[model samples]
Every structure is written in structure tokens, then in C-alpha cells.
Target: MRGKLRHGNVPLRGIAIVAILLVIAGAATASATLLFLGEQPSPPQLAAPPPIPAPGPEPDHALRDGQPGEVGLNPAPIAAAQGQLAAGTQPSPGHPHPSYAGEVSLLARDGVVVSRQATGFALRYADAQGPELPAEQQEKTQNDTIFDLASLTKLFTSIAVLQLADDGRVNLNAPVADYVPEFAASGKQKITVQELLTHTSGLQAKIELWRLPPPARLPAVLSATPQNPPGAVYRYSDLNMITLGVLVERMSGRPLDAVVHDRITAPLGMTDTGYRPPRDKLHRIAATEFETDPPRGLVRGEVQDENAWSLGGVAGHAGIFSTADDLAVLGQALLDGGTYRNQRILRPETVRAMLTNYNTAFPRNAHGLGFELDQPWYMAGLSGPHTAGHTGFTGTSLVIDPGSRSIVVLLTNAVHPSRTWGSIGPARLEIAQGMALALGPPGHDG
Candidate 1:
């Protein structure tokens, strides 16, 4: 009787378990359909994270000498650039080319000097013919070697004019005659101060000032006629800066050099940059050109521009001599919006005006009040509307890219043997491109 009861209960229990399993399967299918149709259950909530803090300001505005990696620059590119400068000294037989005899290049990113190199000989020189010289006679270049700034002197003159404008001593829009009455002699009364700064003043590109007697050069420049109507064309003229230099002297009742020293260089602490470097510093000066016709042999320790040389090595357009380090300070000041080491050389608004494009009429020849703007030939990848720079005939160049707050100073004695040697423009662009590539992507908006 017990065995029969157990068998009957087993079938009843199995049927009840099967019914329970069917209910669970139906419920699971319903859940799967809901999940597949994008109807999943909600998850538990948690608090969101706090916001990130804003970055602080940089420590200083002055360029602090540091390693490339310290400023987030790649050292390889910079080293490669230095290697190129070193190779430039050697002559390749089949492909003989003109290159720097000596170069002092400095690259700065956000006011931190990442690379500073001096290569080749400051005086590995030759006479006007530039034949290779004995090594014993050569003077190796140093970081502090003084270089003739050449046409880069225009930047100083431009800054001085803008400084005077800031002081309310002159007006940018005023006619040139307003400051210098004699400047009106050659139908130039219509030319404005702005036109001279922008190189659209229509003045003749240059006069053989060296040909004229010392007393007559100034008069000739002042009385010279325009090549075209004022602002009607764009032609770079040394006479424009020369005339402005004279205007600076007349308006300030002081020499142009004195005004620049007392106003710009002194305030910026640029001790090695000025007109007529002292005789004591002559040992560190780079040799430039050997002019047989002019009887200047192994030109060194003096201004290289003929017009400036004729003017006693003190002119508005060309005359200033500077070291790579000294120029780095000036470049930093301009990149810092006219202030460096707590000294303000120009008002912020004035700096903005200086870097603003005043030459929309001459698109290819973009210019600021005292700087060249967006020049790809020299500025390279750093070229932009706000980029500023100047090139000197003596193979010196300064490029400041406001976009990156980066500065490149490439000083070469390309004119050492002779100005006839081809241009260093390609090398100039290379140095700037190396810096731009090293900085690479400008990591932050700050």
C-alpha cells in the first residue's frame, strides 16, 4: 500500500514542477522582448564629478633660458637645424652653394628660450673676392657676437616713431610736412606719416647717398620727389625711414640713436643692441664684406649698409648692431605686447595698432606700423596676420609669431665675404620652420 501511494505522488509532483517551469519561461521571454525593444530597467543614480579648475597665468614675461624639453619642444628638430648650420660651412664640390660663414640662431617659445646655437666662423673670411682663407686667421663665432643689424634697424626706427606717437608728439595720419617742413619740397606734402611706416609713401627706393657729399645727402633725401602719388603704390624705400629718422631728430631735439637708447633699448635692458657699438666690443663683432672700391677691408665692428656707413654709422634705417641674446629680449618684448621684465615700451593698444595691417591695398606686402606682417618667405609655418619680422641685408632676421608667442632670431654673416653670394632666405625659413615644428600644435589656447 505504501509503494502505490509513493508512485501516485511522484507524477503529481512532476506535473506541478512542469507548470512552474512554463510560467518562468513565459516571464523570461517577455523580459527578453522588452530588452530587445529598448525598454531596459533604469540604473541606480550617482553624483556627478566637480568641474576642472582654470589654469593660472605664466610665471614671467621675460625669456628664461631653458632646455628644449623644459618648454615642451622636441630637441631632435632643433638639433637637426643646428646640424644644418654646421654643414653649411663645408663646400660640396659638385653642388657648390652659398651659405652662412657664421650664424647665431635662437628659438623662443612663449618667452622660454629652447634653443640657442652659434656655429661657423665670424671671420673665416676673405677679401672682396671671398677666397677660402687659412684657418688660423678665422675667428669662431660666439653666442655674444655683435652683428650689424642692417635693414633690421628699421624696426627700431618704427618703434621710436610709434613711441613718439604714443606720447602725442606726432600723429600717424598727419602729413609729413606737419613734422618736417622741408619734406614737403618734392610734392610730398600729401604723404602721411602712416604711408612712410607702411612703405607706401611713393618715395624713391633709395638715393646714392654715398655718392653725395656728407652735407648734401640729408638735403637730397628731404627734397627728393615721389616715384608715384602717396599711397598709390607700394615700394619699399630706405628714404622713407631716413626721412622719418630726420623727423625723429627734429621732433625730439635729439639724435635718433639717443632717442632710441633713452626710450627703447635702455628700458628693455637691451645693452648689446644699439648704434655704434663701443670699440671694446670690437673683438666679438662679426666681419662683413670686403669692399675694394670703397676701400673698406674685412668690414667689422661697423654698420654694413653703405648709406648708413656714409652717415657715420648712425642712421634710422640701418646702423644698429646687436647680439643674438640681446635681440631675443627685443623679440620677447614685442611678443609680450611691448612689455618685458616689467618695463613697458609701448601701450597695449599701441602695440595692437603697430601689429595691425595698414597695407590692405598691397596684399602681398603686408605691414604693421613698425613690423612686416605675414611674410611666408621668412616666417614659414609661423606665418599669420599677426606675425611680425624684419630681414637685414647683412643676413640677420627676426621673426615674431604672435599666434604662438614664438620668436626666431637667425643672425648670419652671409655678407661677410661679399653681398654677391646668394641670399640666406632659404636658411632663414628653415630655422623658423624648425621652431614651428618643434612647438607642434600649440598645445593650449593659453
Candidate 2:
């Protein structure tokens, strides 16, 4: 401890003590510098991560064949619906004749096809006045029987227009005249494409385009005028869709039928759906009304609407024929937000827009683009503020209920013998009600 220091006047022991103190001081300084530099002196304890939110319920599965019980449906009602449909093929006391000659119905819930039934005959009448076809020559309704969709064709036309809008090829808010300059004539300059879609364009409900010479038909529709001021009221008009069909053709540079097939049916794998189905498919096609004015006999495998026939089996208001299964695919596609079998024909937003009620000004007629919304007259028990569907004059009806994730497709040849047959409203109500009842209360598990 009394030894001398090597280079300083301090004793060796004192020097050792000072060195120790300095070393300790340096360490403290280094720690302070680290602190000043925002370095952690030690790894701090971390908080437990917030609990991950519980996983939401599973999404609906893809459409497939399933029993009623598997999808929370009561089979009794579904069977009853089938019974009613079968009964409809025979004459009732109130009505001396059948409500419809034949029908094919498909019902699905949560993407499961609970029932697909075919009843009666597709080709029953020999003529509009009667004389039943020989049983040997009659074609029984099949699940795949193609039916004339009538006004339901408007839904396709609407989809085509919306697709154009989605592609940025057409503007929904733009005037029709902007796309087809001839549409501007006769004070139609202000009629918007949306107006046409929602049936607010004030155009006449229909015109005898068939009466006009074939060359004049298209021109007449292009230059047609409004019956009332644009958006003044809601009047469902074939002219609207007819005009839109022309617009689709012009914008897509393809025929309307081709566009629907390539973009819609083909993508959905709907093989039995199209305008002017191939000759090979005629055997599976349902016969519609036997017309006299046009002198079309036994209208089998041909369009039922006169104007559509006059237009070469392709028109917006009516023409496309389809089977129940194909339409069920379409309904599911919409329910799944416009996709089926991995094919997306419309964006989810476009689907939402198509389902949204646009005719708030006209309460009685709630329309969404081309779909009739909350229409109880045809939608029956499934009718709701969000339920969307359409009726074809050829006795076809499609009901898609978003609330329950259900679809009902009732395709009938109600006009097979004649258009004078009574309304198929009762049958439409029965099937839809059956579906609604089969679904039971919400949150019910099979």
C-alpha cells in the first residue's frame, strides 16, 4: 500500500484506488450516454398482445345438391310445393284448364340446391285453341328444359349494360344520345342510361316494332321519343331494354346475344341458355304460345315474344331461353356477389348496385337497375325490402332473397296453349312460400 506510483507523485496504493474509481465513473458515463442516445439499459418487459378477435362465421359454401334438412329447411313444405306444381298441370274447379302446361322449379338456400323438380308436359297443346298433342309426340318437362325467359331477358340486358359501365366503356349517367346519336332525336336527348335501366326514362311501355318493316325497326327504336318528361314517373318499358340492347351492341362491338353468351352464360357454364339455341337443343326446348297474327305454329324452340321473333330471335325485352338449373346458377352467382365456379361476371359493387332500389320516387314500383325489388305480386313469402326478382310474360319467375340466402326459379310454359290462360300467380306464390317456410325462422339449424 506504501509503494510509489510509476509516473505520478501519488502512492501506488492511492493510484490503484483512483484507477478503480475512474473505471467505475467511465462505466457510469457510458451508461448515461447510452441512456441519452435512447438505448435500452435492459430489455423491457413487453405487454401481452391484445387477444385476436374471434373468427367470424363461415361464408356460404358453393352451390351444390343438398337435402332440405342439411340447409335448415323443412322438407314437408318443399314437397308440398312440388305437389302444388304437379297439381297445376291438371284442371282445377275454379279454372277449367291447367294454370300452366308445364314447369321446372329449383330452390336453393345458402348455396345448396335443396330441390330441383320437373312436372307436367312441355309440349301439351297442338294449337292455341286446344287439341292436346298426342301423348307419344308430347315432350315431358325436364329439369333441363329450356324456356323462353320473356321480360327476364331484361335482366341480362341490364347486366350487359352494367358490365359496360364496369369496363368504363359506357357511362350509366350519360345520356343515351351520347352513345347512339340517333337516340337524341324527338326530345330524348336528356334520357339517361340509368333512367332506361330503372324504367324511369318515360319511354312508352312498348311499340309494335314487329309491325314495322324489318329495316325500320331498329331505326324506330333509336329515334323514339319519351311519353312523359324524363324521370317524371316509373313505367316499365320494353323500349328501354330494346334501346339498351342496341347500346350494348354498339359499345361492345358485338351482337347483344353474343355478348351475353361470351360474358355471362359461357362464364357461368350455362350450356342450355342463349338466344336462338342450336337446332340440336330443340328437343329439350319448351313450347310456348301458338301465335296466329305472326302465323308461327307451335312456337317450339322459338321465341314467344312477337317482337323478339321479328328481331331474328334476339331482343332485349325477350329472347334468351334457359333452364331452371342454369337460372339457379345465375341466382347463386348473384348471391355470392356475382361469381360462380370461380367465374366472376360482375364486380360485387355492381351487384350491389343492381340490387339497390333506385325508384324511391315511385314507391309501388321498387326497381333495381333491371330487377324488380320487393315485388310481392310475384315474390310472395320471400318478398322483402332487399328481395330481388323478375317475372317473364312466358310464365317464368326468379326470386332471390338475400336475407335468407335463398333462390327460387319457377319456369313454366303457362302460355303453351294460349295467352288467354289464367295468371300463374298462385303457383308462383306457392313455390316461393314453400321456400320461405322451408327456411323456417332465421338462425334455425337443421
Candidate 3:
């Protein structure tokens, strides 16, 4: 909790973090230009930077496939993307990797899979000299291998709330206390569901609910004192989603996982995605941050988020693991304006509304109803006036570019061992940029 956004009156981190991201983005753009013109740009300079720490072992699979030379995309999408990307620039070693490494990925203009490759191992233990990967019996990570989608869980909760609103079952404008009466405790009666989705709630984040005893979780959550006036600023609190999970259970007459499965993942055909992964399926799950706090030792197959872990591995803000391929389905569902593979997860209008900016007053937060939008930082080359995505604290990122009709997913275990190890910023950018470099831009929808 001490590492929370230094200020409570506003959103997580700072507005300047956005600006700093923009500056780095500008440099990446410059690098793209140099590479476009046939000049190789220098690799990003890391000055004795602490190792790019990751949870579990280094993803031995990051670069195992789909490198530019190894994986070639269909010419049309690649040509368009190249032209659009080549604007006022020349081409260089475009689809390259940072020191942390990344998988080469490709998504179609229509969200169809055109290409994919896993160029690296999924575990350091698999390295020729390191030792042994997680388990030889475990399946090696392919481009389609499922990843534990960490915080992407919030998007599902947000969409569920929107679906309820569309059916007139819930009101975003109403206070949360309307359904969860005790939610009004601690002067939170004025907070609306919309505020929770947008993270404008005044809840002080992260009270180490997991560290506290079992019975204390509820009181600690209810006792989360406000750092500022309700709606005064934007502070991302895991408590917001936890409360939302509780609300879903109360409103839907079932557990939170049931609502998500019945309404979201199942309908979307995200077969490999969910909370409380099955015992038999553990071998396929990638290892994430190894825990020490609760002294759980190596964390594999379970949710990686601490707050989500505290809540029985199912919460609003975190606690969902998914694979890149499955997420592609979800991302395409949104890009299709709510329909995917003939199934509809949401109406087009609803999808658009979900992606609309609700945090104009809190530019630092720059969030859509539940989605973070146009963030150039972790968004990498996919960033633009219309790029939208969100990053999980556990080294995962998703960037969608409406302008290009593209989506890039980068799932990593940067927090594998501990939260330390500088940042995965470069890897995020390279992953998105790699996809951008491959796809170029779109012409028209068929």
C-alpha cells in the first residue's frame, strides 16, 4: 500500500507519468522512422539498469516464434500498416525485441488471426544451461497458449454492469449503497457505480487485506478511509472492484465467477479463461510472481494479484488468468462492435459507450467506462489518438488501435520473483509495436 499512487486526491500514479510515456513514445517513433529509412536504430540504452525482473522464470517462449524474418504476414494488411507506419519515415529493423524479449504476434484488420509465433522459451529453467523449465510434462507455450489475464477481469465486471444497466436492472447514476447497503459505511454513500468503474471513488487503496486475518477483510475494506472528497480525484483502489464483485453476486443471485462465465467468457468462447483454474489444467498455466508475503513460495496456476488472491482468487480488479488467443477473441468481440464469430457479447452501441471517455475531468486517469484509452506509455506503437488498452500490475498489457483495427497482447511475469526489477515499459512498447509493424494500417472493412 505504501507504493500506491503517492497522492490520494487524484488517480493512480501521476499525470506526468503519462507525459513521460509520451516522450518515450516519441523516441520510439523516431526509432521506427530510422528503421523505416533503412537505417538501424540503436537499441534502447539501459544504464546498468537493474535486471528486468519477472515472476516465475524468464518466459523462454517470448521470441521463440514470429520474428519478422521467420513469420511473414499476408501482404495487404502488412502493406497498409507499412505505408501508414512509414509516413514521413523509412523502414529499419522494425520487428525487433528489447532485452526482456517478446513473442511475435499478428492480428487481422477484422480481428482474425493471420499469424503468430513463440520465439522464446516459457521458462528460464529451459535455457540450454540454466536448469530445467517448470515441468517437462507441461505443455510448451505456443502463440495460442493461454495466459492468466490478471487485471483484465475489471473489463468483464464493467461490461457486466453495463449489460445490467442496458437491461434496466442497475443504474450507474445511483449510489452503490442502493444495493449493497453497508457499502455506504465510512461516508461512501455518495459514490456511484460509474465512479467505481472510472476509479473516481475516494477509497484509499490496498489495506493489505490478504495480510490481515480472514474475519478482518470485510472491516478493513469497509474501513477504507477516503483520501479525498468523493469524486474529487481518481485513485484506483482494488476495493472498488472487490465491492463490485460483491454487488454482482448480490444482484445476480450467484457467485461472481458464475456471472462472468454465463454472461461473458462462455458467450465469447473464452474456453481457457476464468477464475479458480481447474486442478487438472494446472500444467498448462504459466508461473507468475512467486509470493513471499503470505509465504506461499512459488505461485503457479493461481491468480497473481495480491488483492484478488485475498478475495478467494475472484475479484473485480484482478484475479483472472487467460491466454493471448482467448483475449484475442474478447478484443475482437469489441472490435467487431460486439459480435464475434457470429456471437454477440455486447451491442455495438454498448461497446462504443464502454470505450467512450468517462474520465474527461480526470485526464490523468484517461479511462473509458472501464477501459483505459489512448495511453501511449505501455501502448507502444499501437498508441495514437484512438489507441486504447490497459496494463496489469503483473507484467501483462493489451493495446487496441481502432484506427488500424488492431489489437496487441503482451503477457509477462515481470513480477515473477518480486515487484522490483525496474519496469517492463520497453517490453510493452516493443510487443505492441511489433504487431503494428506487422499489420501496418487498414484500408476498409469488408
lDDT of each: 0.76, 0.78, 0.59
Model 2: CA > 4 A from native: 1-61, 442-446
TM-scores of all candidate predictions against the true structure: 0.85, 0.85, 0.74
Q: What is the Å distance of residue 405 in model 3 from its true position?
A: 1.4
- Which parts of model 3 are misplaced by more than 4 Å? 1-106, 125-140, 437-446
| Model 1, C-alpha of 296: deviation from truth (Å) | 1.9
The full ranking of all candidates by lDDT, starting with the best, is 2, 1, 3
For candidate 3, the lDDT comes to 0.59
| lDDT, candidate 3, 336-359, per-residue tens | 666666777675555655665556
User: Which is better, 1 or 2, measured by TM-score?
Assistant: 2
Question: Alpha-carbon error at 209 in model 1, in Å?
Answer: 0.5
Q: How well is each residue in 303-328 modelled by candidate 2, as lDDT tens digits?
A: 98998999998988899999998899
Candidate 2 has which clashing residue pairs, if any? none
Candidate that would win on TM-score = 2
Question: Model 1 over residues 165-220: C-alpha lDDT tens digits?
Answer: 77778777678799999999979888888789989888989988988899998899
